[model samples]
Target chain A: MTAKISIRGVTKDFSVRDHDEPFTALHDIHLDVRTGEFLTLVGPSGCGKSTLLDLLAGLTAPTHGEILLDGVPIEGPGLDRGIVFQQYALFPWRTALANVEFGLEAKDTKKRERRERARHFLDLVGLSGFAERYPHELSGGMRQRVAIARSLAFDPDVLLMDEPFAALDAQTRETLQEELLRIWEKTQKTVVFITHGIDEAVYLGQRVAVMTSRPGRIKHVLDVEFEAREGDLRADARFGDYRHVVWTLLRDEVAAARQEAPVG
Target chain B: MHLLKGLRRVAAITLLAVVWEVLPRTGVVDRTFLPPLSEVLTALANLAATGELLDHTQASLGRSLAGFGLAIALAIPLGLLIGWYRPLADFLNPLLELFRNTATLALLPVFVLLLGLGETSKIAIILYAAAWPILLNTIAGVRGVDPLLIKSARSLGLPAHRLFQKVILPASVPTIFTGIRLAGAYSMLVLVAAEMVGAKAGLGYLINYAQFNFRVHDMYAGIITISVLGLLFNVLLASLERRFSTWRATS
Candidate 1:
């Protein structure tokens, strides 16, 4: 399979102050995301996993190196790459249907068509009866589901998620993870997920890319060979081995990240 | 139940009016200094019958609404721009502060000199007084939008316009509405003061004319009318706020 997203020698830097020294957020990052694959970037806080996702989504340009989507240089944010955030960012004034329709507004779709399409996606996300309810009226998980439906409504090639379940309760997160998997399987869209949760990474990703702290760089890339369906996999002997290996690789990096004072 | 509650309020007001009507007639106070409540009501009826009350009310309402609308139109977009762009805010903040501090009523003479002592000058004074609250509240509202929400919108590949429309506008609605309500109150207050400066009509003019003519009953009538108008405007805005915030309340 061809790589859907290719990041080669990507480096990102931030200037702290007018007179202060510049800091590197990502250092010489190189990664490839295969088409229709679920890839997770996992690391300690400040390891620049979210930064890497931002770059991949073309929300920010890389200071050095290029990110190509299907071998085309990313000029700016486009509908081809959809993003879901940790906090549900649904528009408070808009109902679920309107929120989903927002992504399609740039298209030349008619108002009736947009509403119909939005309704379809809302139904897909189990919000069929709540198209008229505003974001403020929904629960946290419901809001996130609306966000996901909104992104998917655009039919984007890749979905970039930044700790999309971090703010949710354990039960809600697990339910969402299963829902995400079902959606991903049905859509067959490539996914680049960033998270700090090891189990989440292991459970969802075809490959888990672990990173080291400040001036973040990739430490290891492990291919997950677990069953796609969520049953007895946690109890699998190989699952424990994979977990142990990832934990050992991340141990020192977590400590270093904890010790380092964060700078904007 | 709501109708019953409203009836109770009307009953209480009527009781107070009855007490006022009885106190002066029963010699509890000097009748020369204080007219009975019935006399004030009689004066109100006379003014209404002659169409003077309606005319004055319409003039006052026109000035207040015009100034209030102009202030909202000017403040919302300017405030949003300043709030969204830090450099612009830094440059404009000091100037805005100076303008806000320059005692709007003090500008009455200058406004009259520039626009002439007509309706324009009066309305301009009201606008000047009303603009600051809306502008400041808008700035506060825009700045107060959660950064996380902004980040989320950016990540979702929202274009600049959509980002503002979707996230910034909705998040800032409560604050913007608060600014608008404050501006509404200011407009009413300043319009009265403006009319008092030199006007031939409006409730303010009527009050001033009554005081000069020593028609104390009409003066009190004008004062009561102004108070009622202010209360009515406040109630309308409060209902609007409730309508907008209903979704927030349910969740």
Candidate 2:
């Protein structure tokens, strides 16, 4: 498969304020995301999952090695990649449609085209009737939908999401996960979704990458294969098997993460 | 519901007006010193008829508007720059703190001496008083914009100028307007005090002149006019703020 995003021995480090030694966030991380693939990255908190996503989004440069998009080395944030954060991060001053149009505006899209494309993306996210509503006016679930729409409106080649549904209630989270899958199917954009939820990783990703804690690295990558993805799939025995596999892989890493940073 | 809220808002003022009318008439208060509300209204009407009310009102508004306008034009941009650039803020913060702490009214003698007891001194005082709130608020608004919003905008490949213009500027508006609204009230307060010291034509001068001649009704009328003008300006500013920041859940 042609690589949509190729992570090559990528490592990241942060200098500590008081300490002489620099803290390693990610170490020798290597993964190849296939074009038009739904890849979920799962790891415990402090495992540098978000830092990896930030690296892919070109928000922060890697301390060593490099990341590539198609055949080109990633330099910095560009309109070619769209990112959705866990927090809705919708501009409160802008309406739902206007918020979606933000990236398009940056691209210098014509005013009428921006409006139409914004409305279309808003509709795709099932917020067709709420184009005029501000972020504060919308419910948490709806606001996240607007955030997704905003990221997708600019027609980016890759959609990088950083636990975009984690803040939502259980019911909203599940519903959005399903909707995101549907949107990914329609858009055919290479999606790198980060989540801590085992079920979420299993349900969304065609390939799930598990990471180890403290100087994070890819521990394992398991392919999720299911006959049907509708309704009773979560109740199927195969679903339990996949969830079990992911949990067993994550359990030790989660424990190590807890020891690395004990709660006060 | 709306009508009830409107009536409730006016209830205290209505009760006070009734007390003013009855206290002097019933001899509970000295009539010469504290005239009835009707006498004050009558005096206001006489002032209107002779065009004295219009002249005084125009003069007060002109000075207040000039100083307020200049403050907004200068302070908002200065605030934005100071707020966004850390080095500039650090460089000027102590100087700002010093001047902001000094009372506008306390410098009345200095203003009179430096600018002379003319419109320049009065307007300058109003400008000095109004600028601080706007400048401080603009800085705060800029500094207080959610970092997440900036990150999101940056991920979209927005240039620095566009990021500041689109994300930072709009996000800071509600706070900046908060400053402007405060400055509006400050301008009114400083304008009255400045006018009382020197102005030949404002509502403050009119009140001072009336009090000296023992025209108590005229003095009360001037006080009432100032209150009414202040209330109207407050309403205008609130509506303007609402217009700019429509996304905020109305409190």
Instruction: Give the root-mean-square deviation of each candidate in angstroms.
Output: 2.8, 2.0
| CA lDDT, every model vs. true structure | 0.87, 0.93
Per-residue lDDT of candidate 1, residues A21-98 (tens digit): 778999999999999999988899998888898898787899999999999988787888888888777767678998
DockQ of each: 0.48, 0.62
Q: Estimate each model's TM-score.
A: 0.91, 0.95
Interface RMSD of each: 2.7, 2.4
- Give per-residue lDDT, candidate 2, residue B239: 84
Give per-residue CA lDDT, model 2, range B44-77, as digits (tens). 9999999999999999999999999999999999
Deviation from native of the Cα of residue A44 in model 2, angstroms: 0.6
DockQ value of candidate 2? 0.62
Q: Each candidate: how many clashes?
A: 0, 0
Name the top DockQ candidate. Answer: 2
**CAPRI verdict on model 2?**
medium
Worst 10 residues of 2 chain A by lDDT: A255-264
